[model samples]
Target: MLDWIFLFLTISLCLASRLLLSKLSNTSKKKQTLPPGPRYIPILSSILFLRRSLFDFEPILRSLHAKFGPVLTLRITSRPSIFIADRDLAHQALVQAGATFADRLTATEASRLLTSNRHNISSAPYGPLWRLLRRNLTAEILHPSRIKLFAPARRWVLDILVNNLKSKSETGDGVVVVMESFQYAMFCLLVFMCFGERLDEKTIRDIEAVQRHLLSSFVKFNVFAFLPKITKLVFRERWNSLLAIRQKQEEIFIPLIRARRDRKQQPGNGDGKNNSNRIFVYSYVDSLLGLQHPEDGGRKLSEGEIVSLCSEFLSGGTDTTATALQWILANLVKHQEIQAKLREEIEGVVGSEGEEIKEEDLQKMPYLKAVIMEGLRRHPPGHFVLPHTVREDVTLNGYLIPRGAAINFTVAEMGWDGKVWEQPMEFKPERFLAGGSGEGVDITGSREIKMMPFGVGRRICPGLGLAMLHLEYFVANLVREFEWKAVDGEAVDLSEKLEFTVVMKNPLRTRLVSRRKD
Candidate 1:
């Protein structure tokens, strides 16, 4: 009878403990109201909703937004990522409440290894270090004046591009795969800027190969990004591959860095007396070498940091610009009427006198600007911006956004919003004209977010000014020099496939015939 009494008491104690735990869990859930999302499953959560590849996940996210509203939570493993598809909300979060949402997301093991512990601008958290680096880049390398100094480099690359295309068109059956040539031209231009030396074709190609290989592998390791610690053990081969790529990068970039450093250290080079003009033409590496971080007590950047910055500079300028160039050129080929109009505009402003288009002439040609903007809107290089994180728990649209939650803005969706743009799917450059609906639309999205191809707020792309100049300069020159006609048998396909940037799936095959013999 005493044993039975003890057993009853033990059962009652267990029941009370379970009830108390349940109450606490309910209270916690009520305190922090997460946005509506798909039902969470144990361990897997919403990750099962993703595709085998992350590049193809944009469409799925769009569908989720349609069902759960513009703001929704996505529980990918243990982390909850909040995605914002509405333009106003994005402006509010990235601009008005900027600091609260200004921090960068925690880098994955692969990203950390690639970025050298988040030293590069895109991956760097919002802090003094980011500001210093960004200011140095803008003032020293990417300023309008600095960009003007690289005019010769641009001209050299353009000449090479024209000559190669002419030769290929003459030899081949008027159908040439122009993507490789375009990529090489862009690489050459950026390499000259990064290293301050015109490298031979072989070296440029080697660097391009390694960079592209690493970029291609980045998306493939998406699973490892979330489950980094465990996946390192489970996916040993992939982890090793990433390490090898990093090692290869170091090997290539270090020599380039040392050469520049050695040159700067030479007696006359430092005085800025004998080589004043040359010294004025500073490369990105020169600026980085001189940077002394205040937060780190005047600590100079390490070799690894230099490599990561240089790699970022090269990759950021080349791949995205090349991809955008292809899309713009392809559109010109597809819409012959629009192409004719643009050529007419170019010829009108800077006559068909066989002279290269000057940067100053770009301001006079509104149609040309319109065409480029339209292309960016239709085919943004990145479907989504790099993930941003909240510094503290904040409320957005009356929903609690807990601290450390990852957030991303839908770049492509904002551009394609039918509510803002009339006939959003149609390729209409006229929409950006003076009297049109999108006239005076700001790409930065500070005042209002009509369209944001380069993003906005404190983290807007520092290279915006340079990127615009490159696009306009190249597009105008290409059209002026050649009549880009679609191949008779092989038409231009606009279908896109995801890479580091969204590139043409079939690649652009076109017929190029020089308008002027000169």
Candidate 2:
């Protein structure tokens, strides 16, 4: 009986091997007509080549493009994936074929853990619900009037940042400003904006701390994010940690969300102290609260959903803008002549001795605008602006990209591509200023982009206005207050390192010489 069972097992193994070989042969035949790429090896694609240096994915891709034309397919765990770096092809995929290219992050579980299953505008599919949420966000919360209404909040945050930086500059070991500190300050302000005038600094810090902690465990979290199905068995520890962090986040955000709701529904008492007569600034939360889950006509978002949306606000605004500000400063420090010219423009417009720089004043400073633009071109915060997925079957440059394939366009590569700009590596703000080789280069997302720091297409950042304000305002102020030099003798190392955002592997350490022209 044992001999018979062994023979049966051997027969079964032989049949399974033949079936696998037949499938491979068929797949190879189909791929022959598709764009040329490296030959696929079973299971090793993910381990050998698919996992790219997140920061420098562009260069590797460009090399691939050089070897095998613009559009090429790569295998991830035997799955065919498409990457587009060619400008025209990218436009076809992203803009003309907008709805066809949906967000391809397949970790529904990760989204659930991170966002508590809230139908976030970023996470929602291309449909009526997405349209509703996007419209609400655009019309109510992110509108020009609504943003202007939050002027107090912006001012309050800026004050905190400036004062805090000034205090640090005065005392501690030669005024070392961690770029992350600016991010923290921005995070605090946005938290207030989302939650209302609620959370104290310590409470806010705890929330921020958890976010940072979770972020540090990103590899562990992403292991789950990429393979959500195997997450329970494979990354149970990281998965649980992520869920735990989500719970902690809820402990803080839920009360604030509920309180705001309560305040809205509760009648105003006669006492002015209990004044419920406040006008709504029409924030992101307010817009979300008004949404209905179209599938079942479900009620507005639960606590978890609200938390995820708010998390995006804080995460999105903080890291991108703050890292951008740091890069702009580092560049200014590196190129003193440009910095001098910027300060001259700012001082000429606002006077060297002013009480504070106003928002209106930023418009008149064209050089400042150019400097900021140059910085974004030089150092885009999100290296690849959250991987956009192909939603439906599409062809780019005669190559077919099937639905559900992950697509990543090279942002940093586009910015530094020598084909687009001469001296692409040089820190030249004048490239963006008026007449230059890059005179026609469109930084505005209205047109097909040569470089996309805030991303391109329908998914372009709505906070462009606010982000510009922060960068220009803070940078102009910092340069005006101090003449930044690379710590007298030490060179400001320009080596790039990838984190949540690209930061200097060696942080920008510069000596601040007082530029008080008193």
Candidate 3:
């Protein structure tokens, strides 16, 4: 009887201890109010929620925002990713508290490999290195003065694009797949800027093939980012394929880099050369070659770093701009009245079809600017900016955002907010014109939470200025040159597909007639 009593007491004590521990754990959890999110399955977390391709998550995210509030958490892998769909919260985090949200989240393995371990500006941690590289790009290559120097290059590429379209129109049954030509034109322009040489069509096509291969395969490589060791062991073939792609990238970029370095080492191309004469002659690689990182005791950039930077410059300038142009042109084709209005604005500012639309003329064309803005508002390139990490624990809208949480602001959602933009679904350039609802609006969300397609604050795109110039210049010229009309029985489909950029699902096939008879 005594032995039984002792056993019963011991069992009671163990049960009591477990209850106390459970209570404490519950109390701790209650104290930390995390953002609202969907119920996640154990171990797998939100992996099941994610599509194989990350780009497909945009619609899912939009749906989630509708179900939950603007700010929500998604446990992707082990980390709790906080997504902010509200513009005010985005401004609060990314703009008002810049430093808190400035640092880039730790890069994926594919990104690390592609960027040569965070050496490039886009993926680099916000620090002296990033500052230095950004300064070099801005002051040397991307400055207004430097951009003006590229006018001749732009004009040359414009002629090529026009000719290519003309050739296609003649061959095809009045319909042409214009995305290829648009992409090639952009690649040609950027390649010229990167290497200061007009490469042959074959070489340009080769570079395009490799870059597209890498970008398309990026989603596949993301598995390595999550389970590096496991992925390598289980999917060796896939790993090897990615490595082969990287090898091809090096094969293309390395020779170009070496040639530029060799040229810089020559006598005539030294610092004593006149700045005015070399403005257009100098390539992006030349400025990079001259950069010395103060954080690294004045160490010059390595070949790998140069390759990564040049690749970034080429891809960033080419792919995104080209995709945007396609979208803008598609909208113009879809809305004939909008197109007529834009053409009217362009002609009013820069004269007739025969006249060349100079970069300076773009400043006077506000409706043209509005159309570009409206396009970006409707279709942002990336649904999310590259993930950002919180530097320290912070309170956002009464919810606790802990340190080390990967945060992404929903760029497309903010642009489409009905509260901010009336008839957000409609393609209305008038909203951005004088005395309209969005007049004097800032793309950079500094003063208030509004449209931020290019993002805002210190971490905004360095190429924003250049991107705007390219868009305006290209759109004006294309409109001035061609009457882009939909082919008979073929309507312009604006259905979007997620690629490296958000592209048209059915690529814009249009009939282009030259405004001027050659």
Index of the highest-lDDT prediction:
1
* Model 2 residue 220 CA deviation in Å: 1.8
lDDT of 1 by residue, 340-458 (tens): 99999999998987599988889999999999999999988887887788877888898988778888788989999999899997888999998887888889888988778888788
TM-score of each: 0.92, 0.88, 0.91
RMSD of each: 7.2, 5.3, 7.8
Query: Comparing candidate 1 with candidate 3, which one achieves the higher TM-score?
Result: 1
lDDT (CA) per prediction: 0.84, 0.71, 0.83
Per-residue lDDT over 1-518 for candidate 2, one digit per residue giving the tens place of the 0 to 100 score: 45334433443455457558777774644653556777765434443332444555555667888999867766644456676667766677677776677554554566656865536667666677667766776787667776776777777777777666666667766746557568877887777767656468888888788777766566555444333454455546657777788788788777877876765454452232245565444456655666787766667767777777787777778888888988989988888899889989988988888746777888898888888988888888876766677666666776777667667777776788788778988889898877865665666544666788877776777677778887887788777777877776678787788877887888777667666643
- Greater-lDDT candidate between 1 and 2: 1
Worst 10 residues of 1 by lDDT: 42-51
For candidate 1, the clash count comes to 0
Worst 10 residues of 3 by lDDT: 42-51
* Model 1 lDDT on a 0 to 1 scale: 0.84
